[model samples]
Target: MKKILLLFILISSVSFGQKKLDKLLNKFNKNNVPYISVDSLASTKAILLDAREEKEFKVSHLEDAILVGFDHFEIAQTIAKLPTDKNAKIVVYCSLGIRSEIVADKLIKEGYTNVFNLYGGIFEWKNKDHQVIDTLGSNTEKVHTFNKDWSKWLKKGKKIY
Candidate 1:
């Protein structure tokens, strides 16, 4: 009985935290780009774009994720690396999905038909036990939280500045 109660509490806490994050994201995102959950993205073959800075990306990122960067995003350079097919599925992610929306919107403006912003970005991905890789291409538990204020959202993984 105690074990079941503990499990219930743990699950409830995680769900509540997720709700808080969802509310926060809703307030920041313009909803111009649709969101893809971590689970959904894990099974998809879409091109993953990390919209965080290069420093943040070095700590850890989704496997095969291309860095387009948020602060220094260059549309021309980004486009050059994408598939010629305008309909190719693409997903963009940032620390907590805010910056990704901006990048994803740029992609949409450039006429990419199937671009999506990762629902909760890399933070949520690690929280969900999804794999992230370092610059060496080795699996890593560390995730760049962007900063201290945003670190609360990441429930799993080693937090890196």
Candidate 2:
């Protein structure tokens, strides 16, 4: 959709001279789906799922979000944490958004309706001044960049190595 792509461009374009995020625009999803925005997410009643690795997750994540992880993701594990109502609204996200799309796709196939991928993941979320919490559930400016290259996309957070 134009709105999603435009928002993606607006968000990804924020980092000066950072094309690293732009290069991954179409890398993740083989099948495109509707994306959830940070503003909308702030007011929504959906369950949030973090699709990053455990280490990445520990650095920071959306408050109350459950980590389903990307590399070691187990559908069984996700099922265990999911609400009993299969129709519950769910949003999946990762560092950039690609990996989360993968997770969201799987959720759709599993027949858990009303699933969406967060447009730009935690990077955009924090950029928009949204709060992310650490393991202790404390508010943190620290965010796990995943690596040196990916760290450039984050502007407002204290980048964690």
Q: Please provide TM-scores, in order, for all candidate models, with all chains considered together.
A: 0.94, 0.84
lDDT of 2 by residue, 58-141 (tens): 989999899999888899889889988989999998887888998888888888889988877898899889999999999999
Q: What is the C-alpha local distance difference test score of each model?
A: 0.94, 0.85
Q: Please write out the lDDT profile of model 1 over residues 43-141, one tens digit for every residue.
A: 879999999999999999999999999999999999999999999999999999999999999999999999999989999899899999999999999
Give the best candidate by lDDT: 1
Q: Model 1: which residue pairs collide?
A: none
- Model 1: worst 10 consecutive residues (lDDT sum): 13-22
Query: Model 1 off-target regions past 4 Å?
Result: 1-4
For candidate 1, the per-residue lDDT at 20 reads 94
Q: How accurate is candidate 1 locally (lDDT)?
A: 0.94
| Candidate 2 C-alpha error for residue 121, in Å | 0.3
